[model samples]
Target: MESTAGRLTRKTAIISGAGSGIGAATAELFAREGASVVVTDKDGSSAASTAERIREEGGVAEPFTADVSDEAAVIELVAFTAQRFGGIDIVQNYASNRSLVPFDVAIAEADLSVWVQQLSVDLLGCVLTAKHALPHMVRAGSGSIVNVSSLGAWLSFESRPAYTTSKAAVIGLSKSLATEYGKQGIRCNVIAPGHIVSAGTENMYSDEQTEVMLDHVSAPRLGRPDDVALAALFLASPESSFINGQVIVVDGGMSAYAPMVPSFRRLAEAT
Candidate 1:
């Protein structure tokens, strides 16, 4: 398929929050697939390390430091990529900054300042990146954008209203953009990953909590960062050209089943 035709050869991809987790994983994968990847994160050291690893793997990569929520920084990031790589064929917005505390506490106990900080980075961040990157893409008349949302967008959990709201909004935003830009040759999509195992998860779940979560998943094991990255690659590639304004849930069947924790032992015993 022409969609897979050189699979990113000579193409350029810009990913935000590439310092860790899904962002870092996607950056490495895109590089490996033959794209010149620009890795950006608020943490310079971590972003640099991600880029270095990609370089070690014979992939072309570079690191930059930027806060994706900042309008000026986002604009600069777009410009920098164009200057560095000549043009951008793919854009992935993966920067999110929010402490996963219970929402009720934040609403009742915390100040307004805290709320704004959460929305500014998580919800507004994706908007800002798309706003800045779209025009560059429109000028070229073709591009693909993959926005990283989360399973929280669809289902409710304890203590994370802000994060959930923000992620949910990303799906709506992507759909709106996709509708507006389809004629312009720019395809916008969302990838909602559920319960990925990473440093972030270590902070969010205890060992027991992780086990309970995995037991509920239809897939046998917890999702790795590479799993999400590979999905992003398909959406970003021409292989999925007809796909637009859609949210792909890569959650090991977590979203497909009931919300309660499952008992693997019980199922096995029945068998």
Candidate 2:
């Protein structure tokens, strides 16, 4: 086993969607914590970049190209991780896909393909990853699975019916995994992130848009990829051994202060 000076010493983790954004951040964070990381992404080059960076930083890591939505690919991914690291210990199922559809449209007007596409990658992908990885974790007597969900799962602020529905299902699936597999020493939890500035979303945050978002966000600054990464590390490490089947919202207090007073109003009223 490869041990380091950090919390995850001697542990191995499989992170899906590790090509960029929160996935990449989590992979790098896990490595720094003394974990041997298997960085899997649909984009082979992106996955390799993340793994190479980890190695450069004196961590154990490797990249694999796998589509979480595909059962065969998921199975192969789990097998490869177990073979390389001796057994599976952690899995962060974070891969997701969504179609660009205006939120104003009703679900009835939404295209069926969008629903299938989003569900396949976001919901079913998590299931397949757990299904294949659990047996190994079960045999090993302990494991942690952190499924990345979105704040949209619980809030109505966003559109994309398929996207919201799929994300919500993730929380439900994670709870089931935790309840059913708790006896085996395997834990599953959900991480719900809001307004994270990732590679996939940076361009969408215009100055005006950011100002509006800040009005809703109680924190001084917007959320970051590391915020979510650190939360995942906690759930994946021994520090959270007794924590399972819970939803950790990393939104900088956005959800907590929902229906907040408008920023303009706060400014006009002053303190």
Candidate 3:
């Protein structure tokens, strides 16, 4: 089997949301795997730091800052990558924000502000990035897109209506793009990640909740950023040329198992 590190030598990649979390991890990994990486983030400083880290490791990388939801910024980002790296071979759409508002409350009390905010970052951002990058990839006759969605797209979560809806829409959009561009030699795939440990989860999960979450997963721990990054690498590489229009779940088997039930018998015995 060919190692993934050598798989991307002489290729070029563009990754959004490359400041932190999964995006940052994937940017570094892709660079190590022999790609000239373009790391773009809304945060210029963080994106620069990520690019510097890659350079320090003797890898080729450049950083750009942009709000991916903006059309002009998206166009500029695509142009910058193509100009700098010659042509883009891989694109990882990972820019998004999260919400914790309950649906009923949002419907009854809040305006559509919350909904639009989530959609702007999670749904429209992907579309804008993909749209701008498509023409370049089409001209080259080859490209791969790895969209980062959430497991909440499939499983229901309370107080997260906006996030859920946007993620679900992302998968749908990815499939449509794949179908439309398959004959054009472009592949689009979505990855729905579950319970990944990040800033949001660190604040959301209580100690007890964390323990319960681990019990629900086949893996003994919560999902890590690198876990998803590695998956993104596979999807972005030519190694997955035959794989397209698919949504891969990376939730440590949480989606495959039934909810964990606390033992009432044990409770009674303890009492």
- For lDDT, the strongest prediction is 2
Q: Write the per-residue lDDT of candidate 3 for residues 167-217, one digit (tens) a residue.
A: 999999999999999999999999999988875467777889988888778
Alpha-carbon lDDT of model 3:
0.85
Model 3 per-residue lDDT at 134: 92
Alpha-carbon error at 75 in model 1, in Å?
Answer: 1.4
Candidates arranged by TM-score, highest first: 2, 1, 3
Better of 2 and 3 by TM-score: 2
Where model 3 places Cα greater than 4 Å from the true spot, the runs are 1-3, 99-106, 260-271
Candidate 2: global Cα-lDDT?
0.89
Off by over 4 Å in 1: 1-6, 98-106, 259-271
TM-score of each model, in listed order:
0.92, 0.93, 0.91
lDDT of 3 at 70: 88
The digit string of per-residue lDDT tens for model 2 on 74-168 reads 99999999999999899998787532444324687877877787888999999999999999999999999999998989786545778788889
lDDT of 3 at 40: 92
